[model samples]
Target: MTPRPGRADGCPAAAGQVPGPQAGDAPYARLDTEEFTATPHAVFEALRAEAAAVPVVVRGGIHAWLITRYDEARAVLADDRMAKDVRHWRDFHAGLVPFTGDVAVAARRNILSSDPPDHTRLREVLLSAFSPRRIELLRAQIARIAGDLLDRIAPRGRADLVAEFALPIPMTVICELFGVPADDRPGIRTWTEALFHGAAMERMAQASNEIDALLARVVEIRRADPGDDFTSALIVACDAGRISSEELASLLRAMLAGGNETTANLIGNAISALLQHPEALKLAVGEPRRWPQVIDEVLRWDAPIQNSLWRFATEDVEIGGRLIRRGDAVIVALSCANRDERAFAHAAAFDIARADRGHVSFGRGRHYCVGATLARLEAQIALPALFERLPDLRPAPGAALRYRQSTMSRGLISLPVQFAATPGRPAATCAS
Candidate 1:
């Protein structure tokens, strides 16, 4: 018997019969699992070739399609039919797709998960805050933060760069942006770490509550005593009745994650990439102008955000000659698309000088990351500063980086490195 259209059972459609899941392909359940995070590139490359729109079972056996081809991924991301509104996702609404902790918390309300008017409204409010001019204005401050982080770590000779340098700069910036007091930052960092990195739902809930309480207090204080900060600016908007309290809270939460996690990872990933290629490291360290190119290449080669958040098909749609049933969850492999053989020559190679390196790491269309400029600025300043401070900086001899267990964010859990303990280091030790 012909299966009913949109049936959950894995079967070929009568008209557009696409290939089923291949043998030995890892299940979507592996997302956020240790194995998947360690090495997702190989699998993504395989999928892009074999099945650009591959079907897999996620946690709880929820069926979803993963798009890997550059063209297809961009098309899906820009297609309004493939909406970001989780409210319309049948499986999630039906409670068939179970999400734990931070995933569930973030899905409730945020620009990342919303669609249409809600997305527009949420995005508009924060757009000005992340404008290019604003981000450029942050350059000097970012450099100082980077220098200070290095000063403390340089004396140690050996340190986990991820913990000592990469993590703190963005965390500090985001806290300052949100007007989070210095006293509250440590606790906020703890909550964010648990919320994003922890696997247990119970612990995640606890962290979320703690964060919520802290944010609430910040909002109240901002309301009472408006300051020259992002949160205070938001409070002004709230006072004018442009946004509600709930929306304000959700926006702040989203910014905290967006502002800190991705930027930190970008810095770490860039360092790792350069360290592996000494020539590139020499170029980046010697010529500061090449930093922009290096940053762009790093974004494409080892993206901080590997895959886009979930988007569900609003109706049956044909993509890459495959039938996607309505309400089916679709994820665009941003890292994979950036490395698509069809789009980029020598896709696997990490060449900073590569001219064709426009990547979807910050996403595309209306949902493109609002924090892109800030992230790039932070990386631009942070990378050069670290290299200048410790020109002989190299990865710890035998240490390996463990990636954070997450499908959405690609970041190292730790990155150990050592540099010579030298005083009054020349800013440009390499030949210009």
Candidate 2:
């Protein structure tokens, strides 16, 4: 049943739940550094060595404790005391958060920002669309999409995988799944990128508003003429009083925007990781059975989502011997936790052969990514298809690798590559 005492705002006043307003501490770490984008694990490693959690300043002057260690990160992600509701954030209550009204709605209305029973209800209805059988049924379509992408780039002998293939596959699949029109998908992708990545931070507010307006329109259309789409299902739930109208719109954005970025990054990251490690690439490309292991190592070594969303304490709690007071927000450094030596041996090294392939990349407990299965299915299909078609994929010489600017999401802005343009489908790289 209900595990902890809730506040007047309906947030749990449990262990991770933050207490009322109190004096705050100066931030000890800044997540906006260039180093974070280039080498985030280094930052996480430094912080973990100091403590499990340390006070940090995120962008927009949001002060919170960054959870670096694996044990603390896992605990805080699942701890009932660490609530997701933005109202539990003391900074928001004090008008210290810089979010505008529209931006504020985006921050607080989604499932990521909600706690039970609202989170419970929203997640229950949302997860129905991502069920195992439904995802498996999509396997053929995902494979077709991957093959079609390769066809377009195979003859070029050179390509920016991120722009040409990796980005479009998930963006296309997810948008179509949600009933988003083909013509409108490109604009939505642009807006979503600007909202999540820091390089385009100047347009963050504009992008948020545009995305919201578009999602609202989608919700309105589904309400009148229902279709075979997840958005339509969410509309029915809204009408059935299963979730609020606000949540319906937010979930649509969450699903569309969140699904696209995570999978896109996963594909790009997997390709890059495999290319860097020739032996691993040989195993992944030459040995079809080990694709799953290759995908797991890429996820753990360089998670698509770096420092993910925030969690606030509804009340005071102690983590790693540090007393985190109520109202203090916490960001779990997923990238750091996955590489934590305490959790996995030789965590720093990217080892595909490691038997302990577990990681918190998609998160844990109640907030675990609903699209985890879909993401995996897409990557499992994408990787083998690319290497099989190209067979000799390798990084373009002198092209420097660059990641997107957002501290929250870790993904390549561009992934340049050179490959052989064979006449027919290249012979299978993996054994049949």
Question: What TM-score would each prediction reach against the true structure?
Answer: 0.89, 0.88
Query: For residues 1-432, could you state the per-residue lDDT of candidate 2 as single tens digits?
Result: 111222323434445434332223423576767887787778888888887877765555455678898888888888999988888877666555555322343365788788999889889989975667767877887887887778778878999999988899998888767877666777788776776764234576677777888887777777778876788878878888888887788888788777998999999999988888889888777779999898889999999988868788888998877778888777889998998999999999878889877799999999999998889889999999888888888899998889987768889989999988865444462111
Candidate 2 off by > 4 Å:
1-27, 100-106, 199-202, 220-225, 424-432
Q: Give the TM-score of candidate 2.
A: 0.88
Per-residue lDDT over 166-229 for candidate 1, one digit per residue giving the tens place of the 0 to 100 score: 8999998888777898888887777667656655677777777888999999999888888767
- Global Cα lDDT for candidate 1: 0.78
Q: What is the lDDT of every predicted structure here?
A: 0.78, 0.79
